[model samples]
Target chain A: MKGLVIVIGRDLRLALRQSADAWLAVLFFVLTATLFPFGVGPEAATLRQIAPGVIWVVALLAVLLSLERLFLADFEDGSLEQLLLSPLPLEVAVLGKVAAHWLTTGLPLIAAAPLLALLFHMEPAGLLTLLLAMLLGTPVLSLIGAVGAALTLGARRGGVLIPLLVLPLYIPPLIFGVGATESALSGLSARPDLLLLGALLLVMLLVAPLAAAAALRQALE
Target chain B: MHRFANPARFTRIADRVLPFVAVATAAALGVGFYMALFVAPPDYQQGESVRIMYVHVPSAWMAMFIYVAIAVASAVALIWRHPLADLAAKASSPIGAGFAFLTLVTGSLWGRPMWGTWWEWDGRLTSMLILFFLYLGHMALMHAFDDQQRGYRAAAILALVGVINIPIIKFSVDWWATLHQPASVFRLDGPTIHPSMLWPLLITAVGFKLYYVTVVLLRIKSELIAARLRALDLARLKAS
Candidate 1:
């Protein structure tokens, strides 16, 4: 537990020191969301209807953009080897890294989601649902993206490879997240969608770190 | 099972089995196509366009089945570190991708006449598309590393992660189809499907499975030979 906290704190401090790295995801999220209106035309009703999907999709892409750097820095600087050699279980260390990733990237995406929702003229209930859905969804993204990041460690063209690997896995969350917001927009019960998102988050939380640690072990070997 | 893990023994057994599998595949497919096109009655609603189901449904089945096979093989490779298992998993992917592609194309062909568009964001089609993407990712990841073993292990891990998506694709498509459109054009699960139609579908499905087995065996054989050639080249380099 102590080791996990220390690892998380170390990653969090590093991320905070290079704050631009975190903001870049947020900026991309906002910019991409802004472009959808232009591409689809500036009609309000259409934007309002498509808002949930557009937001979720761009948020997915933004999360993917930051995933490459998750393990690359440590792997490059040789600290990943030291961490592997440490007494802390590699899974715990992985959980910490994933947590830091969620904090730096997922948290910011969630924070920025509402502003983009507002720009798309989302209603108050829909905006809140979007926020809630993102809160549950983005952690799942970080967790799964951790596995992709770890698997692609030292691989060629990992940046291009990560999205291809991760986006297909992101479909369920994307469906449920957008479903929740769209439900709220239409005055339907969003509970089922939110519950599904929560279930997916819990499942990913359990599975992803172990898989990532295993991938890390393979890469290290 | 463990005995067959030996590649030389497996190859010996597979070489004997391949001819049988090939003959069975050809026979089944020949009969199945004849049955599907000539014997089975056209749908009262869809007319002759219903023939596409024989190819589309079976290809879709192979698409999912191959992914499951890959996942199981990957699990064995990761847990037991069986090199043959790794090769089997890697060899199966492109075949799976091909099946997925055929599913999409035939589906689009059916849809153009039936659904009035070449594509629809309909759940089953979208899920199959995603499955295709997953196969592509697996193939890309398998070749990404310079080290063969490293690439195998990484791709194996990815295969396991992707196995979760299969169920989601199945259920989401089912649920989405049910919610948005109550009666799909083709109803395979309904009691209304006649045995004549059913038998041809079953035969074609079995044929596709046999074809998968035949090709995968050939691929693994080639992969083993390739590995041997590489070893010989390395040894020759060392001697020089």
Candidate 2:
């Protein structure tokens, strides 16, 4: 448990030092969300209607963009190999790294989502639902993306490969997240959708670390 | 199963099985296509367009079935380090992708006439599309690594992660209000499909499964051969 905290602290410190990475993800999220209105037309009604999907989809893509860097630096510097040699189980270390990833990238996306939501003319109730959904959903993204990042370590064209690997896995969360926000906008209870997102987060929390550890072992070998 | 893990033994067994599987696949497909096209009566509402079900449903079934097979094989490989299991998982991906692609194309063809659009955000269709992308991702990851062993292990982990989608695809229609019809076959109460339509669907599904078996065996055999050739080349280089 202590080791896990140390791993998380170390990663968080590193991420803090290089804050641009987190900012880049936020910038990408805002930019991608901004493009939707131009692409679909400037009508506020149209933007409001599509806002849940547009924001969630672009947030997913932004999360994907940051995933490639999740393990690459550690792997390159041989710290990953050293960390694997430590007494802590690889899965715990993976959890720590994923936690840091969520903090750095996913947290920022959540913070930026409402402003983007406003730009899309999302209602206040819908914005809260979006915030709630993003809170539940983005950690799942970071968790799953860690698996993809770990798997692609040392692979050729890993940056291009990570999205192909992670995006399909992102579908369920995207569906539920957007569903929650849309339901909120339409005056229905968002409970079911939020619960489903929560369920996905729990499943990914249990599964992703183990899978990522296994992949990391394979990559190191 | 362990006995056949030896490549030489596996090859011999596969060689014997291949001819039989190939012949059976061709015969079943021939009969299945004939039955699907002529013997099965058209839907009263859908008319001639219902013929697409013969291919689309079977392909969709194979798409899910093959992913399950890959996941199971991957589990075997990861747990037991079965030499042939990874090869089986890797070899089966393209064929699975092909089945998934066929499902999408045929579904689209059917949708155009039935739904009046080339596409719909129908839950089943969207889930199936996601399955197709998962297959593509698995295939790409399998070959992405320079080390075959690493690639196999990485892709194996991916296959297990993706197994979650199979159940989702299977139940998407029931879970969501969508244009795609809910499960008519494989229900707890029993299949709702009429016997006339069911027979051809069953026959084609069997044909597709047999086809998958035949191709998988062929692919595994070639993969084994390629591995051997690489080993020999490396050994020759060392001697020189």
Candidate with maximal lDDT? 1
TM-scores of the candidates are 0.97, 0.94
Summed backbone clashes in each candidate are 0, 0
Kindly report which residue stretches of model 1 are placed more than 4 angstroms away from their true locations once superposed.
B176-186
The candidate 2 chain B region of ten consecutive residues with least summed lDDT is B179-188
Model 2, B136-170: lDDT tens per residue? 99999999988888889999999998896556434
- Model 2, residue A110: distance off in Å is 1.7
**Runs with alpha carbons beyond 4 Å of true place in candidate 2:** B168-190
Q: Lowest summed lDDT over 10 consecutive residues: which window, candidate 1 chain A?
A: A121-130
Task: Choose the strongest candidate by TM-score.
Answer: 1
User: Which residue pairs come into collision in candidate 1?
Assistant: none
Comparing only chain A of model 1 with the true chain A, what is the TM-score? 0.98
DockQ of each: 0.77, 0.63
The alpha-carbon lDDT assigned to residue A86 of candidate 2 equals 92
lDDT of 2 by residue, A1-221 (tens): 99989999999999999899899999999988888888999999999888888999999999999999899999999999999999999999999999999999999999998898889888998888889999999999999999999999999999999999898888778778888888899999999889988988898899899899999998998
